[model samples]
Each structure stands twice: as structure tokens, then as C-alpha cells.
Target: MFALMQSARLESLHLSVDPVTGLKAVIAIHNSQFGPALGGCRYLAYPDDESAINDAIRLAQDMSYKAVLAGLAAGGGQSVIMRAPHVESRAALFEAFGRCVEQLDGRYITAIDSGTSTADMDCIAQYTQHVTSTTAAGDPSPHAAMGVFAGIRSTASWRLGSDNLEGLRVAIQGLGKVGFALAEQLHAAGAELLVSDTDAGKVRLAMEQLGAHPIAPEALLSTPCDILAPCGLGGVLNWHSVAQLRCSAVAGCANNQLTNLQVGDQLERRGILYAPDYVINSGGLIFMALTHQGAQPEAINQQLLRISERLTGIYAHAQAEKRSPARVSDELAKKMLYGE
Candidate 1:
């Protein structure tokens, strides 16, 4: 693990284990060059401790690049709690986790992500004030979905020759908070929706509420659609899956959508426009950062509007340079962070 961290150039790794509350967590700070580290607390069950540490390290690095590209005055960090069979004492676990955050002494800030919720943030806030995405700040998922929606429209405008989503077929491969909210926006815009989720209830909800067609989770990528939106977990667009995609473009709120950097080249070769995941799904981070700084709601919203504009410029630059959008975005983010 030390060798991996050294190879990845991680800043620091902190592990906290509380036997009484059964809380086992890892906080990985990837960078603090821009400012204090800011990231979400992801509580999930990993196969092993190594998996948890690896996830924290990778996610923390992504957050650093994401913050720099989004113009947020924060660095990158992530907290991953290994889930166990102690659901009855979840609050105690969170409180213990909060204490861990407090120990960071403002170097790392925590927010809601994946298995964690705003209520969980509230629990963490009890032990430390360095938290965001609480009830007071409202849910960041909708804002994230909004940014992805804007990116999808921008992609359509560039690739399909129009930004209008009317009658456009969109396959959404997840019905989580952000995915469902994104479905609402796309449906309102008259887009034809094909939704899938591991949860049957969520798929049913989309079908009943948004009039979306149901697609099997395993078949979401290959399903014929104008756009493929992956709002679920990462690594869906791997080398094998990239060859199977039938969509004209890929855009969603999921982090690290591509399994490897080479997948971007594959997408380009397949003639599919790829919206860089961090660039498109930065609304949540932007919201949490500005809210932490006490920015007004309007100011937060206006900042989110820049997401689409940034994506548009990236797409245009990619076209002008005849390069992949993913490559272009990486260069831009690196230039912003390291002045390369």
C-alpha cells in the first residue's frame, strides 16, 4: 500500500478504526497545493481493506483534479468507511468518523457521497464542523444532475447539430438520487428515456413517474440510444464495453467513467463524443465548496452554469485540435494545476 501511495503521489493516508462502534475508515488526501482538501465521505462495503484504501486514493486524486478544473479553492481528499454488519449502530459509527475528521484539523472536509446522506453529514457535524451537504445546504444530487443535463445538451448541440433534447433517446444506467433527478429534467425536456437500475423499485419509479422504458442493467450500454448516461458506479466504460456502446455520445454524473485512459481513445475511434466525467459532474463539488465558504444560493447556481460552458469549450477545442475530449480535458486540468 505504501508503494502504491508513493507511485500515485498521494499526500497522506489516515486510517481510523473504532472497535466499540465498529467504524473502520480510511481518509486519503491526494493534494493540498490549491487549498485544504475537500471531498465526500463514501460509506460502502468493500471486499477487503486494500480495496477500500485503493478507492480512497484514486477518488482523492480525482477530486484534486476536479477541484482545480472546476476553479474551486480546495484540494482533493476522500473518506471511505468499510461497511460491516453493524447497521444498528450506524450513528455511533458516524460520530466516530466525525471525530476522525476533527483530527484532520481543517486539512480535510467531508460531505455526502454514495452510501452517505445529508442525515449522515448532520451526524458528522456533531463531532466536527468541517462537513457539507447537510439538510441546510439541501441535496447536491440535483445540482449535479443539472450540470450533467447541461453537458448532455452541449454534447448534442456539438455532435447532433442541435441542443434540443426533444425526441432524443437517452439511456440512463442508474436510478439513484442524481440519476432520477436527471431523468426528471430530461423527461421535462421531452427526451425519450430508457432507464435501468439494480433496484427494481427505482426502475419502476422511473417507468411510472417519467414514462421511461425499462432496460436491463446488463444491457444498458449496448442499447441503441442517442445518448448513454451512466450515473451509477465507475469503470463501466472499459475496453470491452467501449466496443459495445451504441450511443452517439456518453455523458453522466458518475466519476471515473472510463476504466483506463486508453478508453477515451477507443471512444474517439468509435465516433462517440465523450464528455469528461469530472468536467460534467462538478456541480456537487462546486456546490459543497461554495456553500462551505458561505456563498449565496444564487452565486452557487451561477457558478454551476459554467460547467456546460467549460464542456462546450472543451468539445470545441478537441474538434479544432482533432484530439479526444478526454485528452484535451486532461491537458487543460494539468495545465491549470501544474502550469504544464
Candidate 2:
């Protein structure tokens, strides 16, 4: 399923794949009135070229909304590199991507996305100077996870009417960089934890590091918890899955978590305080925005703290208006885009 629901506001889009260079990339630029496009580079295996193109278009559209919500000056764009697990490719893929970016010439600045890391960006930098990886000085996952944790705290405080989560039972799905960092923060706050991952190494690491209970990925969502954190992929909460979840609140760092707008409202209808994914996942965007603005980590961190406030405000507004958080957040995002 595609992430974009369809909108006439969309200005332009582009998609391509370079086979001769042993590179498969789909780059889409959605809107650029604010400035040149900037989005993450995701390495993944798609079912077909159409799937890759669809993901590129959808994520680029999401980037437009995300950029506006984060109050950034750049437009939206995203690139996806299709590859099999450990499939042989090279700097050639990035170099070919660099060539694509050069053709665009600053219209799209590549950043480290899923299936990619900063080290990958190091290779990508050889091709284009407009590229950006999470130069977080420290581990990017911790920083990325910190933003999500801060958002989670704000969400729990707003929803539960309690800022102290000494005995809160939280289930984290995904022990990747973001998940591990979030688990660390939650553990520090005296929260009971249950974490799981597809990677046994990461699961073992989380078990050793945070003393979390390991479980299969499919079971993580229904594992009877106060808050369900999905820091992995999109479309985790959908028509078939939402009705089965037992969490009090849904919050995480993944983009496009809901299959559609109505599903978010369904969660709200079920008395599940759903923290809008776009709103909650703004941490990464916020970090990227600040970096794009040439700010230091301290300055960026200080600014990121306000996300708690922004999320809190959104929560309050949603409650007061009897609106879904997704709708409320989208209203806020659209306001930014429309300059209303």
C-alpha cells in the first residue's frame, strides 16, 4: 500500500533506476517552493520496480509534510536504493546516485535513511557534496531515539495525566539503534520493559543492556503493555491490527505508521490515545532541520526539547477539539504548508 492518500497540492515528482551502474534508485521530489528538496536515502528490497517507485513517491510526499511540520525551509524528496540482503553492490550504487543528484544539482540533498548508515553516507559523499548523514558526533541512533523518547514522555504525560512513569509497562518493537536508545531512556525512567527485534544480535544486546524480555516481532504489538512503540517501519497500525492492540497509547519514531487517516481515528475511537506518527517522529526531521540550518548539537537539542511542548500542544488541541491526533497534526502541518 502507498503512503500518500492523494492530493492536488502535489506539484511534481520524478522516479528512476540506474541498472547499468549496478544501482537501483528511485528519487522523487514532491514540492520545492520553500527551497531545494532534502530527504532520506533508504536501502531496501522491493517486490518490483513499481513498488520502489511507489515508495519513493509516497515518502517524498511525506517529506513535504514532515518538512513543513518541522518548519524547515527545504522542500520534499526521497531516494530508495533497492538491494537484496548483503547483495553485492558498491560505491557504484552511491556514485550512480551521486550522478543522479548531480543531475538534479542541489534540488535534493541525500541523507542517511533506513538500510543505510553514516558510513554509507561517507561513501555517498564522494559523489555529491550536497549529501548529509547524521553527523551526530555520537551515535545517531541514540540521538534519534532520544528525540523519540522525549516525544514518548510528552505523549504519556499528556495522555495519562501523569508525568511520572515509575511503573509503566512499555513494549518496544525493534531493537535497532532507535529502539535501543528509547529503551535506555525508558529504563532510566523506571519503566517496565519488553523489547524484541528481528536481529538476534540486537535482541541479545537489548536483553543484556536493558534487561528486556525478548519476543517475536509479530507478538510485540499484542504483548499487553501500556504503550506500544514501533520504531521500525510504516503501516504497523492498520484496520486488521488496530482492533487487536491492547495498548493505552501508541507512540514511536516511525513515519507513516497508520495505513490511512481513518485508522488513526479508529484508534482514537477505541480510547487508544494515539500519538500521531508524523508528530512523534519529528525528532529526526527536527535534527535534520537544525543541521540544515548550520546549528550545533546543543542548539539542536535545545530546540528539540520544544517538540515535547509542540506535541503537548497538539495533544491538548486534539482533546479540546474532539479531533484525532492525526487530523490535528495534519491540520497543523497543512497550516505550515499553506502559510495560513
Candidate 3:
């Protein structure tokens, strides 16, 4: 565990367990040069404690990069609550997790992430004032979707020599809150949508409302399209998948899209324009960070608009250096976070 933290540059890790509620949690804090580490609390079933701890550490590191590139004065942290069959009472479990967060004082702030919702954040807020994305704070998914839409436009302009989405095919792999919202925006922009999700209900809703053609989840990645938007889980772009990609560009709101830095190199070699995941999918973090600082709505929107500019800058640097954008992004973020 100490070796993992060292490799990831994690500053601290907090573990807590509540036998009564079957609550087991790991909170990993990475970097604090800017300010308190801010990230989401993920609740999901993990095969083992090591997997949970590793996920928290990896996500916390990504959050640090996301926060730095988004120009926020915050670090990165992530907490994961291991879902077990023994866990009963969701509310009680989250409440216990909240107390765990409070124990960190102001070192870390929690929000909603995968397998967690605004209501879960509300439960966390009960124990610590250091939480966001509560029901009262409003959902950040739509704002994140909007940023991704803008990013796609930027990517189209850079790669396709035009910003027009009309008549272009986009394959989206995920139909959750953010993904569905992004599909609506893309549909309105006249982009042809090919969507897939684990939930048949979500796929049906997109097909009915947005006229999206449904693709099987397993086949979405290799489907021919102008772009591939992975709104699902991370590590979606690995060796096997990258070799089969048929798109000109890959951009989405998913964090840690590439399995490792080497996969980014593969994308570059394949002549695919890869938008760094953290740089492009930072709208939610921007919203949560600014909201926590009491910034107005307009201020938040302005920062969101900067997402495209940041991506374009990264693309340009990558092009000039003949390096993958993901590599350039990591270098730039490291410079900001550690002055390395």
C-alpha cells in the first residue's frame, strides 16, 4: 500500500470501517499544493480491498490533474465505499462514510461519483460540511455534458477542418445522466448518434427521444464514426480496443480513458486525435470547485467555456512536439501540481 501511494504520489490514505453498517471505505488524497483535495465518493462492489484502494488512488491522481488543468485552486482526492452483500441500509452506510470524511477535517472534500448520487452526498453532508453535489447544490452532470459538447466541436474543428456536427456520426458508449444529456445536445446540433448502454431502458429512451440508433454495448467501440465518446468507465482505451478503433478522434467525459500512457502512444501512432481525459472531462470538477468557493453561475459558465481552449492548446502542443496529447497533458499538469 505504501509503495502504491508512493508510485501514485499520493499524500495520504484514510481507511474506515463500520461493522454495524458493513461500511468499508478508502479515501486517497493526492497533492495539496493548490488547496484542499476535492473529489467524489464512489460506491461500488470491489472484488477486494486492494482493488478499492487502488481505484481511489488512481482516481485521486486524476482529480489532481483535472483540477490543475481546469485552473482551479484545489488538489485531488477520492473516496470509495466498497459495496458488499452484507451492507444493508444505504443511508446508514453513507452516514458512516460521512463521519470518516469529517475525521479528515478540511484535508479532503467529497462529492458524487460512480454508483453514488446526490442523495448520497446529502448523507455525507450530514456528517461533514466538506461535501458538495448535494441535492441542494444541484446536479453537475448537465454542465459536464455541455462542456463535452463544446469539446467535441473543438475537436471536430481541429481534426475534421470544420466545427459542424451536422451529418457527422458519433458513437457514444454510455447512456447515463451525463451521456444522455450529451446525446440530446449532439442530436440538437444535427449529429447522427450511435449510442449503447448496459441499461436497455436508457438505450430505448435515447432511441425514442433523440432518434439515436442503438448499438450493442460490446460493438460500439469498433463502429465506424467521426468520433467515439466514452461516457462510461475508465480504462476503456487499452491495447486491444485502441487497435480496433475506427474513429478519427476520441473525446468524452470519462476519466482515465486510457489504460496507461502507452495506450495514448498507440492512439497517436494510429493517427487518432486523443483528447486528454482529465483536460476534457473537467467540467464537473470546475463546477463543484467554483460552487464550493461561492462563485456565481456566470463565473462557472465562463470557466466551462475554457475547456475547449485548453484542449486546443494541448492538441497544438502535441502536434508541435509530435507527442500524444495525453503525454503532453500529464507533463503540463505535473508542472502545475509539483513544479516538476
**TM-score for candidate 3:** 0.99
**Tens digit of per-residue lDDT, candidate 1, span 124-242:** 98999888999887778989998899889999998999999999999999989999999999999999999999999999999899999999898889999999999998889999999
Judging by TM-score against the true structure, name the best candidate.
Answer: 3
Candidate 1 accuracy as lDDT: 0.92
Worst 10 residues of 3 by lDDT: 81-90
Report the number of clashing residue pairs per model. 0, 0, 0
In candidate 1, which residue pairs clash?
A: none
lDDT of 2 by residue, 151-258 (tens): 888878877878677789888877766778888899899888888788889888878877788878888877898899988878888998998898899988777788
Clashing pairs in 2: none
TM-score of each: 0.98, 0.92, 0.99
- Give the alpha-carbon lDDT of every model: 0.92, 0.78, 0.93
In what order do the candidates fall by TM-score, top score first? 3, 1, 2
- The candidate that wins on lDDT is 3
